[model samples]
Target: MADEVRQHMLECEARTWLRNGYNTPERIQELTLMIANRRGQVSAERLIEEMRRQWRRRSEWLN
Candidate 1:
């Protein structure tokens, strides 16, 4: 059940990324490495905070 939900969520997120023209496998790999490398040195909260910051800036520019 959880796995099914996870798969659906991944699909939906991938669709969103594709629509935004940022659905490259290389970008995904870089993101994976960035998260993994920071696991011991940084927290998930901090990483999400940065993502939110960037997304907000992009949204502002788009609008």
Candidate 2:
């Protein structure tokens, strides 16, 4: 369940980036590569941290 939530959040964030023109296909490919390369070195904690960071940024902008 948690993993599903995380994935949905990831997709949401990616869509937000793409819709706002902050993401290009090449950039997405690079980010995909980064994730692919972090198979063993990265943790779920770090991924959640990034999601929190994005939420913080959005919240700040809404202020």
Candidate 3:
């Protein structure tokens, strides 16, 4: 199903962030909750966009 694919992609991306040490515990926790609450209820594009926004904010903070 499309939702399955989206969830898979989201998990993959989260793993990448974890592997790269780009995610903080708090951020990871937040994302986990967001994904849990939104999966099936929201589109993959929207979820990824939210993650991207978080990534950008973190990047800005780091810079």
Candidate 4:
């Protein structure tokens, strides 16, 4: 449960970064590495997925 909440928070942070123009691939990779170091590879992967989902949603909303 706690881990789920932490992952949710990480997803939210990733979404915010995407909304704020930190959508570069290099920046995303950097964030993934940081999360992997602090959390784990799985968490980092989750963050990447969340960022991708948010980016897709934003693109859809815009177009």
TM-score, model 2 to reference: 0.38
Count the clashes in each prediction.
0, 0, 0, 0
**On residues 1-63, what C-alpha lDDT tens digit does candidate 2 reach at each position?**
999998777656644654454444565555556655775335433543454456556654433
Judged by lDDT against the true structure, how good is candidate 4? Answer: 0.79
Residue-level lDDT of model 4, residues 1-63, one tens digit each, is 999998778767877778766689888888888889999999788878888887877765443
Model 1 deviation from native, Cα RMSD in Å? 11.0
Q: Please report, as a residue range, the 10-residue window in candidate 2 with the lowest summed lDDT.
A: 40-49
Return the top candidate by TM-score: 4
Candidate 4 scores a C-alpha RMSD against the true structure in Å of 3.6
- Cα lDDT of candidate 2 equals 0.54
Each model's lDDT: 0.50, 0.54, 0.59, 0.79
Task: List RMSD in Å for every model shown.
Answer: 11.0, 8.7, 9.8, 3.6
Q: Write model 1 residue lDDT over 1-63, tens digit each, in one string.
A: 998986556544444543465435576456546665867334433444444444555554443
Reference-based TM-score, model 1: 0.39
Write down the TM-score of every candidate: 0.39, 0.38, 0.38, 0.67
Clashing pairs in 3: none
Least accurate stretch of 10 residues (summed lDDT) in model 1? 40-49
Identify the runs in model 2 with alpha carbons over 4 angstroms from their true place: 25-63
